[model samples]
Target: MQDYDETTAFLGQWGRFQQVVFFVLVASNIPNGSGVFSVVFIADIPRHHCLLPDVNITEDWLHVIIPVEVIDGEEKRSSCSRYRLDVVRNLSAQGFLPGRDVNLTELQQEGCVDGWSYSKDIYQSTIVSEFDLVCSEQWKQTFTSTVFFLGVLVGSLISGQLSDRFGRKPVFFATLVVQTVFAFVQIFSSSWAVFCVLLFVVGLGQISNYVSSFVLGSEILTGHVRVLYSSMGVCLGFAVGYMTLPLLAFYFRDWKSLLLAVSLPGLVYLPLWWVIPESPRWLLTQGRVEEAESIVRKAAKWNKVQAPQVIFKDYSAHVDEKKTPSIERHSVFSLLRTKTLRSLTLILCLVWFTLSTGYYALSLNTSRLHANPYLSCFISAAIEVPAYITSWLALRYIPRRVSTICVLLTGGVSLFFIQLVPQSIPSLSVALEMLGKFGITSGTSLMYAYTAELYPTVIRNTATGACCMVSRVGSCIAPFLLELSTFSKFLPYIILGTMSAVSAAAALFLPESFGRPYPQTIEEMCQGRRLKFPCLPPKQRSKLSSRELFESKL
Candidate 1:
């Protein structure tokens, strides 16, 4: 295979291919909004019980029905009665009954009641008089939701490492199939245990969508385009998912329908096996030069250009030759040995952790916002469009260090102000929230680009994945953090803000890689050197331009 200086050409091919790939990958993340079901399940109906009209009573069984207004002030067509008799009948077959095994507190927690608060009179008179059933089994619904996230956290870390070690396309294909199967399986689950297990599997597979998408986009695109395209694509998916979640919850009140609706779209990705190519960059790292060359040729063909006779050589071959035969591959612990790399990893991890925690907590807590939850989520997400655009512009024109530090600092400062401002001024709070969203989104987007630039190719994915694992740790804790008392509503935001600022400070110690070729090995990275063409011979050394030296080294 020939080597060509075809970075520009490869980039053009990447630009066109990424659009189609982006759509399929984005759809896979829709299930991430499954929490919308939990919210809708609780909030849609009131807790009050009103008498049912024209109903006959039977002596053998007692009937208690709660009339819920689906459309306000329209009783004839929009009002429906949730019957406790049906619940009783269902539970009776399972050896459970109403008052004997179930309590008012348990029913209220499961959203079986009709009002915001429990009615003591109705609870004591009607509920106690009804048949007995064990309500503790209903807690499984909450448990399933919690299990889904646990699966997500574990799946994300595993997918990240596997994608780096094996390849993105394989993981993408495998996960899509698994996600599709699990999604459909939930629709027919007979027990809560089965539903929870299936949901966990679905979450586990769904995480690969984000990990593979980000890694694939990063591998193909260069510089500002990489940052802008990757972040905007993912965030756009998130926004769409968020908007669609409530609607899905409303339309498919049953968990089965909701799971099917979200999971079915993932099947479209299965055909990607034919379209998505294995990453050429990854192939080069693994010393599969022939395979890398073939992919590069195909990429050039897609771009309507003839392949160059001598394309870029595989630099990994040379690096491997220098290593001692006895030396094993470095573990995650070895990343900490380099002072600069260690600081970069720690800082990036902190920033990702902080950003994810704050982002999710606010997102989940949107229900508490005074305005409509759907509209509020839409507005919050809309603000991110400009944030991504600004990130692209800053990365393209501004110095890498300045752009990163400024965005991080701005996000932190805005978060602090959000806490100081009073919620009584709803409009001001909304404005500040938008500002905070913009800052954090911009900072988050910038961090991906910055982290990629800081690391040499050998351990790039591993390093990024390790940092992502740390971020997931924060995501795991976000729920508990947000559940803190209302008096300390600002506590999580304050912590997030401080962490972002600290990361920005840490970014100061890292070297900038803008306008420079990516380093292929740790030796090449630490030497701060570039490749230069031989004025004499392969063994001879001579002074040359930095870019020329870097190119020759590669």
Candidate 2:
């Protein structure tokens, strides 16, 4: 049978139907984009010190109660501990004022007994402030992100197979509703435990919707339009959502309000269930020929073109095609069946893991950048605009392998030089970080397209989902990577840089899939990929072949 693109040729590429699906889907992603990174600001660790008890002393002397500690290479008032209140009270009662007769060095410190007095300069009330996830409880803050990712991990594990087993459009709307509802409900959570539980539930749907939408768009759109949807279009939509976060946070300046407001946009997508069609390519894989034909007919109508009366034809798998594919419906194990496939799976797993870690690490680290958190986050989100656009152009023009290597290395090297920059110029460090974000963001955008092209329709969602499930390990660990700053300020950068740089080598082995059609079956998948190394022994007199050795026991 002809490829879906060829089969549906009359339904013009870049026509009105495609345009609606493209933009509506992209718009649907804005809320998701905002939701995914909401934790950045919602849990922001504002400038804070222990709350001071009311005393008959001037406010100028309050700094004396909070002992100076060197944190992240800067001497600042300790957020977790204050000088012994009894000692300070006694000193003041004895007419020995702060910085005069009392030696602060001699005083012992105690943990905040009253509570924290968070600075309202950045956020009025973040989860960090409201939940007191500070100092000793900082692990809660990190764990909160990890829990959400664990939910994402679950989503990754299930969404693809569910999309493959059920259908992309149904799963997309279902997961989107879950994500939006749970996230909104989380805003009203009265306690941190309740909030984290809801966050996990929200996560269950978070990546599910995203993966389904991405796969949905990938399969529905064809040709260069598919490439644009996978890379620039989808990612730019996400950037818009991400960009919206800081702006919302800037106005609300409170965690609950910002997150609550972000979820409202998701409600607008409810009526769009009819606008986006189920992926015809996916339907063809499932043998839902008639339904697939109907959707394409609608598409054909919208494009004002004629579709063939018989849109699909039966295919008794050819000799070679029959040999290449296993089951019409495949599970995750299908990935490990052949040596080439196993190798492909492993390399892509590594690539996904590293990219996720590096991308989210840069993203989550925005709040930590030595700048205004809102502006820093906005710049971080804004950088993706160009990163994705340039990435789309690069993948459209440059070899896929070259673009992947360059972006990963650019991000890696940018991160490497960050520690070398003098702290006196924080803007320089921030600029380097954004450049790093730029590269990773571009690389991430490129990976979505590249990975989609490398697999067949039957297992494409499964392949992508499984890779993402493993990637959740990296993303889950990302928040703690920031905790490495406790060891050394530059330690996190060093680790992120090294991972990004080293992982670039994996791209060397990936098939350059630029301008390639999405593989429709296992046979097509194998045919499209050529091993970089021709290491197989010269064919034996018996005529053993490379493809034979890869797929079957010789």
Candidate 3:
């Protein structure tokens, strides 16, 4: 059979058709980026304190009613406890001051029985404020994000196989619709339980199309074009989406309004379903050469190039099953069918899990930065633009393995030393935080192209999806890791830093693919480890193609 890109070479690498497909797929990722990070604002926790129902304690006596405690080395009013209302009212009637006239420590304390009063300075309403997810229920806030990532985990498992089994275009649009619809439904959710359910489904769609887009772009574009699309193009789109999030949160302080704003962008992407065609490479893999040829012809026309009379070699007439290993049933299990592929898969899982966990953990921890959270979030997102650009340059000019190690180690080291920076210099803390973000963003962004190149085309999506599946485990853990700051303030940084360092070391084992051709079949994976196939090029086959055309029967 004809090589996938070789057959479609008439379309011209980096032509108008490829460019259009690249931009549209990248643009479609905007909402996915925003939706994933929206949790930062949606679950925001503002200043809050206990509320008393019946007797008027007077606003002047608000401090007296709420007991003060030393927390994080600062004397602040208790968020969950308040002096007993009866005792406070009696003290006020006696014209007694809290500490000066009466011993405050001896006062009885009670939980926020009447409900808590949340400050609206940072947010008018959030899931945390509206659902009262504070004190005992505070864990629910992080759990909500965990549930979303859990959905992403489940979605990653199926999205790749679904894209590989079905066409990339259909699966991408289908999941995009899933994300858009559920995001709308989540706006009107009355309770936190219902909200979490909708978020789980939204999470499913958020990353599904992202995976599809990655595979689709990688297949459609060739050479440096593929590298650009996979690395900076898609990642920068995500950064753009993320930057908009803080602006949306700043404008619409209510969580529902922000969801509505982010979800609206997906409607524009629906038209992209028709604009971008199914991947021609994917079409050829299923033995639908005629359909693949038609798409290639149209692409050639769009690029203003002449179409070849016969786009593909008549593989059905020539392919011999006895001469080639069977890849017809290459499911997720194919990744582990051989020892080399298995080792590649496992190490990739570790690299992906570690890097992605740090990436998202750092992303989620934007709120923890000392500056205005909105500003901190925007800066975090903004830094990714340059980071991805730098990544793109590195992918083009630098070796993939070298770039991977450098970025991961840089991010890890930066984050690891954040604790050493004194609180006296908040600027230094923010700078280290941004440096850590930059390093992780650049590293994780490069991983898209590196990992995609390591796996063969037949199971590319499946391989990527499988890696993403384990990586989502890290994504799920990120929020809780960020929450570790509540204990030691620097605990999350230490863990994330350590993980990034580990991933950098693990990346040492992965083979480089800086100037390699996309692997056609499982046997052709990794140039050094080609199995049962010639190093130069091997004939691609289809067991059903020689019997009958897959399209004609359908």
Candidate 4:
């Protein structure tokens, strides 16, 4: 019975057909990068203050009507309240100048009677500016982003089941359309509520399309092509897309314009519907043998190989053999059915939760860094290029446990020290912040490969899915974490740093999966058979082989 791999071996490794699919699928991820991180610009709050109505005072004395407070170590006019206009007018008429004859603090303060004034130097408009989401309403900014990620979590959970039932190509295209249409609709939204609802739908489509593209590529590509597609192609494409966000935001400046600009590029991707093909593997899984055969034949012909007359023959028998191991399929709850699995699941969740939270916290804070928001965001996104490359190298050469623990620790240490960098040297703070992001980014990339390796194949998807969902919970909480800065300037960094450090320590207890065969069952995991290095004395090796020979003879 020939497996799909044996049947497709004649198509040759890294052929033109595989190359086409690789590039096309990788191209799909470029837009996803933008969609994922565009929130940085869309929700950023600019410098603002309470608006002062028509007063017969000079522009230089506008400070007389507003109180100043130190925020993040900078003396800035307060955002929420202003000195009573009547008092200020009476004082100004009496020639009672601010800081001269009168005490500014002594004046009664009240909320902005005429609304707020937003600084347009960096941004022309954002959701914060559009909806007055500042001061007491600041939670709305972070909550909106959380709502989007919540949508991502829901979308991720359903897309897998939907794609399994409906086929990969249809779900992929449907989500792509959903993403495009809703993204555009967000630009036209008349209110924040409408915009947020659209944003949630956009998040749904974003993850759905991304997952479909990934699954399609994995199913269709064979051998090293699949590895490269997963490790380098998709990650680098995402970084490229993320890097493009700052450049686009720099040009568009206005929130509406930036949203429209970044989103319209997805429309160009629509043409891929005509050229890209469905996953033949998915087709076979659904018992569409003829359809699967046609795609395989097309792939072979595209690679200049002769198409086989019979494909997937005896596949049912081979599938039965393959299916026997998983006949008693376990649900996600089964991950905790054993003490060992339960311990591993809990540790993995903590690790995933911290890494995901740290990653997003650093990403969302990019705009707040003491530099040009665009440059800061670009640096944050661009750094992931080298970070991912470093992670790949580490995964190849170093032990998985060592690499994961070290990366998390490095991120933790960097974030812990960021609080110590004196405000006198803003560059140092920014540098440390970016360094922390670099470490977390490397760890984030490593976790996907590392976590999958740790779980046995039967429950691997379920275990990883549960852990990833935990990460989304982290994602949901991160923006709110950023809001903690309102309580204390160093609180967010301290909290994220603590999370990183704790997770790194938890990683030490995880079994190392490096250079070892993946365990096939929960029993193998419970036995801890494959977790150790295979070192043995020469005498021991000889004795073991001799014993095996004697047993075979008996």
Q: Give the alpha-carbon lDDT of every model.
A: 0.58, 0.83, 0.82, 0.77
Better candidate by TM-score, 3 or 4? 3
- Prediction 1 TM-score vs. true: 0.71
Q: Model 2 segments beyond 4 Å from truth?
A: 55-63, 72-74, 99-101, 315-327, 531-554
Worst 10-residue lDDT window for candidate 2 reads 545-554
Model 4, span 237-350: residue lDDT tens: 888999999999999998889888878888888888877898776555444567777888888888898876776665534444443232343566667665566778899899
Report RMSD for candidate 3: 4.0
lDDT of 1: 0.58
Residue pairs clashing, model 3 = none
Clash pairs, model 4 backbone? none
lDDT of 1 at 13: 32
lDDT of 2 by residue, 1-554 (tens): 45667767778789999999999988888887898899998887888899987976545456578888886568898889988888777777777877777777888889999999999887889999999999899889889989999999989979989999999999999998999898889978999999999999898898999999999998899888888889889888889999988888889988888988988788899899989899887766654557877898898899989887777644322222443343345789888876677888898888788889988888998877746888878888899999999998987889988998999999999999999998689889889989998998898888888888888887889998999999998999999998888788889889888888778987788887776677776655665676543222234324533333222210
After superposing candidate 3, which stretches have Cα over 4 Å from the reference? 58-60, 94-97, 316-327, 526-554
For all predicted structures, in order, the TM-scores are 0.71, 0.91, 0.93, 0.85
Instruction: Choose the strongest candidate by TM-score.
Output: 3
Give the distance in Å from residue 304's predicted Cα in candidate 3 to where it truly belongs. Answer: 1.0
lDDT of 1 by residue, 374-395 (tens): 4565565567668877876776
lDDT ranking of the models:
2, 3, 4, 1
Please give the range of 10 consecutive residues that has the lowest summed lDDT in model 1: 125-134
